[model samples]
Target chain A: MDKRILVIEDEEIIAEYYKKILQNAGYEVAIFYNGNDALQYYRQFHCPVVVTDLEMPQMSGEEVIGNIKEIDDDQVIVVVTSYYDPATIINIMKKNVYDYIVKPIEPVEFGATIKRAFESAEYRKMKKALEQERILKLERQIEWFNWHESIIQRNYDRVDRELFSNLHESFNQGAGFGSLLTLIRLIASMAKKSNGNYVIDEQMFELIKKNADVAEKILNIFSELVIIMNRTFEFEKVSVMELHSLLRMIIAEIEKYAGIKKMKIALSEQKPPYKSAYVNIESDYIKKAFHEIFMNALKFSKPSTAVMVFVDMKTEGVEILIINTPEIIREGVVGIPVEYENLLFEPFFRIAKVVYEEFETSDYGLGLTLVEKIVRKHGGSISIANILDSSDISRASETKVCVRVWLPLASEASRGERKGA
Target chain B: MDFKKAAESMQLPLDDYLSLVQKFLERLPQYREGIFSAKNSGDMKRLAAEAHKLKGVALNLRFEELAECAKKIEIIAKGEAQIADDVFGMLEHLIMEIKQLMLAKENRDG
Candidate 1:
């Protein structure tokens, strides 16, 4: 608990009176002659309780209260004024000020009011902490529910039937179903005919190779899904790295993919101060997360346009924004509308069909969902939004999709080292 | 003025009460000049503000008559009441009387 109280009063006599009384009551008191100076001090070092005189020179006490509340809405303020009008008191109370004391104050009553204000501040702090914990618990519950729902909703059966039916059709038009058993019997018959030679004709070998490739691809997807669902990373594997350097590396790795789509990955230049912004992460998992984001950006971007990447430093974290002008913009086309933004990270909720090589596979829509899980496991957050172009005269155009990821900054020591390096 | 009763009402020891009174008297000329200047300049807002300050300190120190006089000036300057021609003169006389009373008490204590 902070025992410091800030007293803002223009009258030196009154200020000194407050200081003396509060100090005698065992509170550390800081006195400012005006609201401006008091607020300036408050921005740097916050005192839980503020006692302000409503009439002051540079900034009125009401302005002071409003500004302080802007900085921290829960800041406890007690207004001290010489005279009070009922309307004035009502207006100040609307600002959520704890209480106001009319001057010519009774000392004991003044002290008691201050005590109650501190108690309220303490209670507010506890309530905020509890609320945050509750939110975190609810988020975890939602994640669990979504994971189980994806599994229980017959996603595996649907994917299996679709893939087997497609493979059966490709093998032969009349190979109705049970494609796996038919293919296995075909392989065994071929092996028996080879009879220790294991030789096959060129056309037969090509057909088997194509089927094997598709099977391997499906196996890989399911393997990744299982790993994401079950694995917990070891904390010891986490390392601190400058975010700009990591982003530059990711961009370098994905530039080839972007180039294949006739798109460019343009990374913003790292400013000097923010070059030292470091984050603690399991580099491989974080790399995979950004790779998924960049790949999605490239896959959806318009030809010859740039997928822009920006890294910005926030108060307690670093934010990465990936912006791309998408290729699809027509009504009812494959685009994330504002209303559907929250569902973008839900498992198996893909909005667009991605064409791989010459065919479109059931994409499972887990790219972003997996990325979200990885980021959240490392105590970061990810969100996507469709940016609308309001500058157009005729209609609002959905111009771009922005994927933002925020990761908590590493310790000061790591940042200092990066700066030195 | 009853010094004992005023000090008791302020919940201050006699010595502490006398010290605060001395401090108030030291600031008396500045307070008087501020009110007089605001009134002469026809800046009723400043006049009301100055009077409000004086009224607050006087009330806190249990200077009942002085507080009442300052309050009237504040109300009149705020345009809530009509200003009397003799009000300023009355305020000056009350201030002088308080100063004399403090001086007499100081001499008697020494």
Candidate 2:
């Protein structure tokens, strides 16, 4: 919305004339008597339209145009000169001058030309903005597609492994189909012996029912697992929430869990501007991702040490860092190595034994993996790295683990909508 | 000087045109001095440059006769033609005439 017009004319009377006319036309005007001064001013404040006289003292209009074009090729320049030679006109045209005004210009026509120049400037600004937006959208789409492909591949691998292991264990342990067959045989034999008299004991009946339930439960769980693995997720249920509010809610919930280990959960205080930074996310899923990461941090943290959470607004998005000091490094219980830090997101990858007895289940090692998957689904990424103490010059031991998560900010359109609401 | 015609060509009100004429008259002495000094020194390039500057301002103010005289001086100097004494004389005459007219308007207005 810059409506300033720069006039570079050596003739004081003519420069004044242009100022009066342009000002009357509702434009803010800055007049320079020489090209050098004008160029200095232009460098500071880029006016939308530049009206420069060709014959000036220090620098000629052609030189001014060349310098301005070098600075910004999209600059709009209009030449004003008394000499109307065809060669000079062609030269100016080759330099990409927008239009030329001869001496003793018609006020109305000059006004019209300047109006067109301003229109061209506006169009160029809009086009540049749209091009940047298009590139960002394409980049996001490419990232989403890449993440989607990896998730699908990982799902297949997990399902295949789980199916083979479950089927093998069922056949070996006789806890599923084998137990059901044994119970069926015992019931048949009891019924045959009864022979119109009730001879089956209540304990025997209860045992048969319990085995049948176990077999059914196993089959049902397998089917459910397959369905979950192949399910297509819909991501339309997103809301724009401030980063501070989301972190506060998660931290409040995890604070209780940290209390049992006599550990403290500390959240870094964010400034007002950064605290209000909004991110578009499914609140429930993002909470789960953060919860898993926080749990991991608390689990590996030395007892009674503080788990520090820092939320920072990065250029591309919001970054949350959870830093926790590990317990004393013992043999086979050291911090994750720097080179293998990325493996933290791989399924079934465990660096050490589970410290918390509550999470001792089949899904024990998949916490960070599931966290990474959920983060990636929301167009985010999670990474873990070991933090070496600055004082430790040898760099032999890592003191802490830092779990970093980056999530994209809410889109401008969504922010506008939120503002309206 | 045809004040109405000049004002109309410049697309300005008579009062605004008169004030612009005053500014031009103020700078006329400097332009005249630059031209004669360059001619005396036989610096054709400087003479042509000074004349060109005067011609551009004269044309903008619709001083057709003055502009024509300045343009002739610029061409003759740039072409390395013989320094005709009458060309300088004619330019002086035009500048004096415009200066007198602008001064008269100022007196009448005051």
Candidate 3:
């Protein structure tokens, strides 16, 4: 196969050298010095293998690498660095870098490394393409299921929307959007996950023309989720004193990406009765949730008004208050909550009236399930109700969602505290 | 284990470990940085730790005489023990031995 490759090395000499070697080996090569410019063509000119040096002047190899690989994990990146150390190893492994070449380069070794990188990249592209093809094939089977179910529903005069929805929704998620809709979604996601490249052999190229590149669209959803997933986490044991400091760290990381709307996070327990109950939570999840909400608040709210985090020891346990300065109405929450959507924790479910354009990605966990299970493990309750605080919810479609997390606290400690009080 | 065999396994030059004083003289800045930085950083007191590592490497590489000198620096840096004159002398002596080894290799290779 005549493979296409992209090289983003700053040195003209090195770039020329690589281009010659790759071209000689029958690969069509493209080179760029700038990171952002290279990134612009990332999807447009999807290459299987990418070679970059550690310190590029403008974006740094690390930044360009973070951007590109997040778009597709399978993109083979061989890092060329002068310094080989344990610290370097830890940082490099985080992005799942394919391999590294330590400098004072050997010409033979360099050539060999690039060959290996191409093989790795090709392997990933082939794997994702095959998985996508399998998913699409499953969808076709589910489409047959959808057809049968739809015909059955047409014959029955009375059918509830939820029940009717369930008939297809169950298999849609299981097989992904019932052949037609979500199979396309998964294919597009898989394409994005594969760095927007596809196996464009004569057969696939023909099929893609009819398919409308649903792979790109489907991949967009997952890409957005990935962007959310990659947000920062200073995963430290945060005491109540460190809440402001934690927020500062969170703000520092995200400030480059999103503007803060008025978020004032304060530890509300002013007295000595403060409890340090630390749960091993992924800070990435917490940051993602807050960033989405803060972005929404910034986009929707009146500027200069303060959005706040008010924490209190509620009956359930520690209640975290994300005080939204309301301008936009929440969407999709009405009547009874749907089971699957509840698990996604997405804004669409929280507010029924929310426009699709306005929705942002949310967190997931078997943790939510397990917490309730463990609460049941130790006999605890879980519930939610919105307090009518002075700063309005009048314009909102649903009440402000203050998620009250009821962790099972130590009863002996509680009783002792109560006696002391 | 034979000190020479241990030195060989560790990939350290024998003569370098033998003349400890000269080696210390040559690596004074590095030794100072690694040792004192470890003291201040509250991380692993790694300079002395690294010296110990070098000692083992030197011993395994059959540079036993120099390894003995490295042990002095290692003990002083790592062990929270005093650096006696004899140990310091061994370090200088090992450094000189290492120079001689390098000089010999150069003469043959050249």
Candidate 4:
């Protein structure tokens, strides 16, 4: 299409003169005798080139130039004027006008300037088209990557399940040894009760019954452990999570244990009208991570101490800090050692055995290990440390352990990205 | 009032040049009112701009004497020259000549 040129001049004859020359050059030309009409014309039709006088009634040509730029900064404009002020010319040039023409304009020179302006307009259009093409190519590449990632994730999950199955089988085979020993003990008690006799006494019968019950409980514990150990995680269903609700769900899972120790779970107040702190994560995996962390905090907290949980909304993410002081480090010990922080998330890693012995608990499970795995899978992080207040250090009994988790926020754009992932 | 000469310079027929001259005459009253208003209000910038516009129109229409007068007035009103009264008088005289030309054509046409 022939490029459109807009001419703005309040002097009727000069405007007509420009219109005639531009029309004769086989260019589409529109003329306005005032700045108002010229600006209106540009707004509606978006002329590629403009020839404007510096001074006009209603609105000045400079204002017209500025307003046109606001609509579309790529417009090519040439300022034509009889005004011989150098300052005024320099000022208009600063506005990025394409060319300046002094009146009475030589027709050849004016036409040449218009041709150059058209070349600039064509360049801008071509550059914009190339930029749009690049964006489309990038979007296509992202789509392909997302598809490839999903396939890889699917295979990884299959391999993970198979590996867990093998591990569980080995564990079950190891538990058979414990089962055999219990049987031998029961058999020994039975043989003694049957010493030269055909019937068992009441006390002997009670002994046999008690041993059977212990065996049953041991088997149940092993089966439950296998179930938890063999659990698999998938990040396919990422969504905006209501962190408060998720946290409450985790707390509820361990509420019975908390009650046994008389440990109150105090949730720090969330900001505002209780709107959910939405985090971008796989909902189930993140929930499982929080549940494990909460369990660990409850298990180690001193009896009757509240497990303090604070959920704060940060600019980049949601920060959840779970703190328990006077926690069980090891039997007589109260605080976790600094070196243990790094090893806390290793699979099957546990605190000192003396802690379990003192508490009379058999399990020091992979809670933190699983929590770290799930957090890292969601592109977030978890940390554990011992924070000592002045009073905590002064008093030998105080041990403050903090478990901090940072989960990135689920912004609208991130949600779109997550869908692709 | 050499209408044929003016038309020849513009490469137009005499009737076309007369039409343009008539249009210029029709706007003369408004131009006169604007010049007087600017002078009475001491608005030198407006006066200069108005005179500059008149200069452009006169030059395009082949009115050489009037264009020269308007250019002088424009220079004076813009404070580039110190001949405001003399330039104003010349501008008025040139405007009267155009008005007389318009009257002569109207009488001849009638």
Best by lDDT: 1
lDDT of 1: 0.74
**Candidate order, DockQ descending:** 2, 1, 4, 3
* lDDT ranking, best first: 1, 2, 4, 3
Model 1 CAPRI quality: acceptable
> Per-residue lDDT tens digits of candidate 4, residues A377-418?
566798886654322121353446777788777665655356
Candidate 2 Cα outliers beyond 4 Å, as residue runs: A143-421, B80-82
Best by TM-score: 2
lDDT of 1 at A164: 53
Query: Cα RMSD (Å) per model?
Result: 22.7, 22.9, 23.7, 28.5
Contacts from the true interface found in each model, as a fraction, amount to 0.40, 0.68, 0.00, 0.20
Q: What is the clash tally of candidate 4? A: 0
lDDT of 3 at B14: 47
A300 in model 4: Cα distance from truth in Å? 80
lDDT by residue for model 3 (B3-102), tens: 3443333232444333332343355456445644664564545656656544543443345676667666666766567756576556556656566755
Residues A335-359 of candidate 3: C-alpha lDDT, one tens digit per residue: 2222332332322122222222322
User: Lowest lDDT 10-mer window, candidate 3 chain A?
Assistant: A358-367
- Candidate 1 stretches with Cα past 4 Å from truth are A136-421
What DockQ does each candidate score versus the true complex, computed on alpha carbons?
0.30, 0.40, 0.02, 0.14
The TM-scores of all predictions, comma-separated, are 0.47, 0.47, 0.29, 0.43
Better of 1 and 4 by lDDT: 1
lDDT of 2 by residue, A368-394 (tens): 766777777667888786655332222
True contacts kept of 3: 0.00
- Which whole-number lDDT from 0 to 100 does residue A237 have in model 1? 22
Native-structure RMSD, model 2:
22.9
Better of 1 and 3 by DockQ: 1
lDDT of 4: 0.68
Interface root mean square deviation per prediction: 1.6, 1.6, 16.0, 3.1
